[model samples]
Target: MSAHSWDVRRLPSAEGRSFLVTGGNAGIGYFVAEQLAGTGATVILGSRAPAKASAAARSIGGRVPGARVRHVPLDLADPASIVAGVAALRLESLDAVVCNAGVLLDHPPRRETDNGHELMFATNHLGHFALVSWLAPLLAAAPAARVVTVGSLTAKSVTLDLEDLQSLRDYRPKRAYARSKLAQMLFGFELDRRLRAAGASTSSVVTHPGGALDSLTPSRPVRSRTAGELLRGLPAGLLVQGKEAAAWPAVRAVLDPSVRGGQLWGPRVLGLRGRPVPEPVRGDLADTALAAALWAASADLTGLAPAAAGPAGA
Candidate 1:
């Protein structure tokens, strides 16, 4: 939690491990994949956008010499593609997986994925649910494993309605995203419990970016497309932290020795437009019943329940 220990050099090199990250083509996810690759980890960048995924890998490969980076086509909304992604990965052993893929409040009307789940839920929650579940075998094959699921401060604003988990009933864009994020948090907490119950031996943690002004935010419905003009008068640091700043919570959650299962980490100042800090999140994220319900619903939606049933099996 030291404000001073935030540099990437302090992190342990992934000399003997392999990593996989979702939505890693840009923004915060970009830093996650890049930093890991810089540390000698065999990094895989998973994205629904295939061409962009390749470009991202090439970019990182250029920055970090001999950086082993792989790109996989993944679509959180399409079950077939989710299946295809896992099949394509072909990992014999995986050291860690970061579920960093997510979508924020962008469009006005609610959208559903190919599976008929709400777009937010499918992309942000269930898609990750299936990926981790499908890869559970490879995770167990490793000497040890970790899965970091990215949550958000916006989860604090959510009021979950199980009946409307898909947003079909009542559609407000931001809240829909909030509910999906809340589901992601609940999934992390519940995942730790279930992974343990299954004896998977994988450490699962939840982290948030707080509020890094990465391109991911601008992609949202910008209140003003020319909002960058406002930054002209602001202090340099306040204007926006680069993509790297947003990677703090993910990196900390992934590598920090003291990080406890189900714990949350993010920036300290005003929800992390500043230095990194492990902060408290809503107590409801730790709710067991809700997490279990979410896991069941997610498995049902993504066709991953069978993989998760009865815990990690031999």
Candidate 2:
């Protein structure tokens, strides 16, 4: 909770805690798992590819001897994959679930998920929405559980369509990405409200790794070598922050007991990147009506009603 120092080494010990991180094979997600596992927390990394997830688990183990790390194959692009992934997770009590799996494909043809929803929307928002709903019971069983949704800075600039949650009319990649992130933000806040209404102890918090540079990020099996070449070509100062630094907010959101439900954390700078801090949620992102509508729409699309379920398995 010290504002002066919020780096990974400053994190508290997590001896008995457990965490699940989606897209944990690379980028911010990978580092989040690393940081958590380094502090003695048991971590399950959910990823689309088996080999990559295994590699990440190995990397964590290599970096921190005796680090408890495992991998659960999870593909956010497909609903069946998500269900199977959750079922495969046999943890007794999950302290936190980090919804970090996402896609940032640009200018590609408009695509749809196996369920016929917009690709980005389904992967970035709907999948996590369903995952959290199914795992609510496990979370509630913990003394203090958290559902951390990864949002993006682009959400601040976009306008969402309540009626057209899917990009049926217009399908530009940038717009779709922005709107999808906005949906995620809304879902996280709305989930907090619902959990509170149900008298559940689990908290729903949202966080964003502001302007993180993939160029400086530790390359993983999933990240393409050419992906950050362009950014590396530019002056290093143009980079807002490295992926490790970017991951601090998310790590804090999961491990910091002081982080409350409906609260958001981001970079200390203009969301570009520095140490983790409490970043104000913009008016649009804080709209109650929008959050409610997004929640309903997500439920409808995923066929999973948001509900507080039974206590964790123990």
Candidate 3:
């Protein structure tokens, strides 16, 4: 609302708080973790690669002196990885978990994860679903713990198809990715509702970074990068904020005390790219039918229960 209010400096000291974030080694996830680390939070940076995850913590520590950053190996594609990551959470109590890792379907040739789930669904949605399920207990144990999951503006572009969740019957990269993201939104909404109904203090909040694309960034949609230059170039128009800016919404979603449970926040402009603004997302993410279906499917995939949420759904 104000020019200087959203600055990271305003974030309270998270000295006693403990947090976990997947994909915190790079991209928008990194920035959110960095912000928390700056506030003295003991942050666990979950990565698919152990070595890379450690390197990211070192990198963050370099930028922010005395930053408490730890690395934990987590690959969303594998349900076992989530199990392992959860077991490795050394903290006696976890204050919050930020599910920041996500993928865009720019490459083709259709892929699938180890669990026989479509690659996009496995990594983007199922992986997160599995992770949250594992970490449910830690969240519930804390009176005001929270989980912040990242969704895409593209979530509105697709609808859930419970019959073909894994895309086993039909597969399209973009559609599958969109479908997974929608699942994330739905999971967050329904998770919040369930937490409340069960009388748990843990809350679920979701947000999107709009579209952050730049010619300088090697990793992004070609259409987006090309369009970035052809349209209006970086940060001006026709493009979303860079990952640095995108990280703001994510950081706020996790650390801001005023943020309410079940609310989705993002940029205020068209396509949600500008400054981080609090707003609910578009679509039926709160749909009970699809949420229940997703919950069951996730349990089946992970062999975990809705009641047995783990430490970190790596």
Identify the leading candidate in terms of lDDT.
Answer: 2
lDDT of 3: 0.77
TM-score, one value per model = 0.87, 0.92, 0.87
Per-candidate Cα lDDT values, in order, are 0.76, 0.84, 0.77
Q: What is the lDDT for 27 in model 2?
A: 87
Model 2 residue runs over 4 Å out of place are: 5-7, 218-234, 310-314
Ten contiguous residues with the weakest lDDT in model 2: 305-314
In candidate 1, what are the lDDT values of residues 15-134, reduced to their tens digit?
Answer: 878888998888789888877888788888889888888878888887789999998998877877877887888888888889999887676777777656778888898888877877
**Which residues of candidate 1, in runs, are more than 4 Å off?**
1-6, 215-233, 306-314
Runs off by more than 4 Å, candidate 3:
1-5, 214-232, 235-239, 310-314
Q: Model 2: C-alpha RMSD to truth?
A: 3.1
Instruction: Give candidate 1's TM-score.
Output: 0.87
